[model samples]
Target: MKKLLLSILSIISLNVFAQPDVKFNITSDWGTGYCANINITPDQGYDDWEMVIKAPGGINSLWGANSVPIGGGEYKITPSPWKIPIATPFEIGFCGGGSSSDIEIISQSFTPTVTEVISEEIWIGENSSAYLNTGKEYYMVGINKDEPEASLHVGTNTSATSTSIVIETEGSDNAEINFQSGTGVSELNFQNGDLSDISSLTFSKNDNGATMSFYDKINSEEVIKVVDGSLYSREVVVQTDAFPDYVFSSDYNLASLSEVEASIDSLGHLPGVPAAEQVEEEGMSLSQITTIQMEKIEELTLYLIQQQKEIEALKKELNNLKK
Candidate 1:
């Protein structure tokens, strides 16, 4: 099967350098029809089928949104109304119904006859540092080709359940990487790779019958949460192949989510963007803490009884002295 690179870039500063003779195939569907508007979601190595046009020079003004529109071809190109001096990549896509089901990208890079990187790197801008920070906010909608899969690499912390993924900020939430299956997805993986520095994961599957597997790599612990009922951080739950079946670790890191939420470094805006911040704690630990607490109470009770006996002996000694 071929992979589709969907790039919905933020409309702004970013230099896209495309190699000459880069072939991309794209099919478009605007369910809402033409004249409908859409916004761009930007990403690096973020390839997709869309057109981006500028002020005919660099990043000046959007020339004509109506002029450069994608029709059909195996070649994926970012259209810029600006000068075509240097080989550049542009970000723009069809927006309608807010559903990406319509826009699909097919790459020629993959073939039984050949092999290459199925990726397209996008530059933040002329200045490399201009890219969005780890804490910076961005919207996302997962696409299910069949089995849903997502991967996020945080230089430090990363966590996920069957239905959600929470990325950590730099030193807290560094980077948010995701991969979703198209329509028929049933699994999510980081390709045996690792994701770190993630704060929280918020996942939803409208189709209840479909199954999803969420993978998290935090603190060298690889947790696999089959989304059907309860997970460690069960914010969004999806019914799995096992109905009424749920499993959670006897031990949970209560501070993990809070640590992630506090790390959303979106320039300090969107105060608590990480949904994990809103998850309600299950009060005292029933599986782990309760047992430990019970044991400690028993030990304390025994110690108290011994102390009481010692006091009685002291009282008897006092009477002997008086006599």
Candidate 2:
């Protein structure tokens, strides 16, 4: 976040005075909310101080002080009397409602006093975990000199238990992401390549699950890659009862050989084969076309089985006639 300081003027016995230094820092930021700390140091002693700040978003919650909206993105933040000491530094912290690019100190007011000069310093704790709200987005970035490794963890609580999704880079050349729901787990991985160049990862929830997408600077494209079967355990179950026999019946209207030939001639590929024109004109993805092709394969298999049965019956009748 960027900070801007305003010029301050003080009048003492008809003499002009310069204002003290004030600094602001945004300690934590979530998508919709953030926390910030402010420090004020005046050249002279004062009994009470009021600081005005112009923030991008309105203030939602504030602590270590009292504040009231004054209009036009400005808030009058006055520290309690007991909190400030004469000729001492004062600090205050607040959490805001919306995301902002920067915060600026617009103005200040304090009771001036004449006293011996004294140096003072005040420190405020950083709020690192302020951004860790459930169902909110957060990110972490780091660099390691010894070995390259980075990870992101997003967790949300449900009733008494919590669910978390983790994405991390393993060793020098592999990255993996996993989702945990009680005891069940699903993972996707990339092998033999480094993801160190990735600047950030964004995740959003959808009806089915969450979707993660990243931009590839080298390729100059936005890539969304989904990997299935990254982990290795499986079971198989065969359901013979569910097999379809409709392709053997006349009502099925299986595609004729001539129709298939014509399709190949006109489209330069079989029907349901992925084509650039089909995707561009019909707005179907390659994966969707591939699924259609698989269905066609199943239909063709049933037609071939029906033909084989007819051929076997003809041969048996011919043998009977010969005998």
Candidate 3:
């Protein structure tokens, strides 16, 4: 009877030890490198465990465990010396350069031994926060419902209330990229990966969403070059309904052609319909400027049509006189 009871107990232990649950997910991919998160849960409490993975390409870096290559595209990952409770899930992660699709877990081994367990500490609270130091870069990424959300940071650090760039999303359709500072105070400088100078852009936003604006500091030569480089194959149909009634209203001032030419002579550029500087000073947005420019272009087209008609009528009268 005693021998039979011991046999039954051993079989129950073996059954519990055989259950191993592991889940692996690729979190983010940036063409060359990718990040993955994994979770492991064993039915029986274990002092430690080892997981082996095979991938089409080599593993570059791993975190949350000690990993060593055992050759032949296999990496052995051992959890740090700590006991994991039965059926409790623990997470590990790695960032590697590989065929992101061709990763598989080949084997996992668990040692069910009683040992002192050290609890892992997580720093972030319900409201996440990170401390940024000057001259350093930080990247934070996570997966929610099989979608990746990420944020990148690089700049001189200041108080939490000061100017900074923040890009964030809520794992949904909405995303916001903000370059925040006092009104009209901050500028974003762009550069190539080789650190060569590109152009600078500025952004301003007020409490009203309509007041948001973007300004580019490219010189007139660069502007001309950009326009020359553009492709314009599509037919343009200017819809009169798109223009606001204010543009045609009697109260609005339309400068004479000579006045426009004089303004261009003084400013060294074709003046905006209401003066670009004045529009900017009044906090008009780029979209607002574009709308006003389109209206002026359509109005100029009408003036050209009227002049062509007058020229054709005068040519017909001159021919009749010659006849």
Per TM-score, the best of the predicted structures is: 3
Report the lDDT of model 3 for residue 165: 46
Residue 143 in candidate 1 has what lDDT? 39
- Give the CA lDDT, 0 to 100, for residue 252 in model 1: 23
> What lDDT is obtained when candidate 3 is compared to the true structure?
0.61
Candidate 3: Cα lDDT at 240: 45
Would you list the clashing residue pairs of candidate 2?
Answer: none
Local distance difference test values of all predictions, in order: 0.36, 0.59, 0.61
Model 1 per-residue lDDT tens digits across residues 1-323: 22333454322222333322333222343543222223332223332233332211112123223343333322233434342222234333332332333333343221110012222232255433332222215322233322123233223233553544455555654586664657544343342344444332335475444333444534434344445664444353333333211112234222333443565553342222223333344443343344444444544454566678989999999999999
- Model 2 regions lying over 4 Å from their true place: 1-16, 115-323
The weakest ten consecutive residues by lDDT in model 1 span 110-119
Which regions of candidate 1 are displaced past 4 Å?
1-173, 186-204, 207-229, 232-288, 296-323
TM-score of each: 0.20, 0.29, 0.32
Cα error, residue 281 of model 3, in Å, equals: 99
* Pick by TM-score: 1 or 2, better one: 2
Mark the regions of model 3 whose C-alpha exceeds 4 Å error after superposition: 1-7, 82-87, 114-323
